[model samples]
Target: MAKSMSLLWGAGSPPCRRVMIVLEEKKLQGCKHKLLSFEKGEHKSQEVLDINPRGQFRRGVPSFKHGDLVVNESYAACFYLESQFKSQGNKLVPDSPAEQALMYQRMFEGLTLYEKLKAVIGYTWFVPEEERHDSALKRNKEALATELRLWEVLLVTFFPTVATLFRFGLSAERYPQLGGYNALLKDRPSIKASWPPHWLENLKGQDNLKDI
Candidate 1:
């Protein structure tokens, strides 16, 4: 039997885009999908909320498949898809215990940690502008930068190849860490497959964050 996926999603949300990228990388073509649009404020409809596990009383969980495995979360979905195929193609996360540990560390830093920082700065002040406090925004900004520095450190520690580092502009003199990490991740065909969907490119110049 063929497996299918429902990509519960909205416009320009990085997490949703990340999941789409992983699906493409896995080449899990047999799955079906439900493309939920944000323009219509569909994520908030009770139907979407009920399926999401994140207490996401607001949005539904997007899922993907390859045969029998139904997966969720951009990170877990990628890991499961790759693990199921056991393909010799580019590996997204290394199989080695030591390297896998490092990969998880960096991946989580980018995924989970970043979400917290964004939440502190944006979600915490999610109220209308009339209620937003400059003091809180300032505090959030400081916290966000501090959390980002953690990623800078992880990049250099993980990626060692110079050729791979060029994409993120991490010259040897500046951000050596991130440059190196980019090099490490750059060669993986699987990771490349996970690049944000073409639709995400629509976010190129929109400075203000929109509800997705």
Candidate 2:
């Protein structure tokens, strides 16, 4: 079954890397996969669109396929893999009900985190320079600061690898704990094995949230 699975993903995309990390953690490295290029718009190619019709309109890497089943959403792909291959690798879903509930809550909250972070910095990447405004950027930074306050507890969570992408903009002086946690996550075997090829080639990344 692992041999029959195939994943289409972009190396630099955090969501795509999240799926890769899950696959590694689940001992599904035998699954065939291809790395698409966002710079070249390979994610919108006909091959991807065939499995993920929404790819035509949305940015859609991290698409997973198992036999006849296709999973388009990154979070769904990770959960499906965890559920289907529960006994194959390291346990992900907690055995206790309370722990499971907390894990699920954190898992879903990841979407809100991504949304808030994107609002603060996505414009510089996706929006045209002419369309970007200082006023909107200010509002986004304020909203993100508020969101960060709510997540001030210890950093153990479902998507640590995905969250590490934000480290580029996060100041170590301002977020010392998160900086240490980010370093630890990057050293994890799954994260290191699935590290983006492009990122390795270019060690530096854009600092879009230096002000935040």
**Model 2, 8-95: lDDT tens per residue?**
9887666787788889999999999898887788899999989888784236788899999999798899889998988988898999
Q: Which ten residues in a row have the lowest lDDT in candidate 1?
A: 159-168
Residue runs of model 1 more than 4 Å from their true location after superposition:
1-3, 53-58, 61-70, 128-131, 156-204, 208-212
Compared to the true structure, candidate 2 yields what TM-score? 0.91
CA lDDT of every candidate: 0.50, 0.77
Judging by TM-score against the true structure, name the best candidate. 2
- For candidate 1, report its TM-score: 0.63
TM-score to native of every candidate shown:
0.63, 0.91
- Candidate 2 has an lDDT of 0.77
The root-mean-square deviation over C-alpha atoms between each candidate and the true structure, in angstroms, is 6.5, 2.0
Among the numbered candidates, top lDDT falls to 2
The backbone clash count of each candidate, in order, is 9, 0
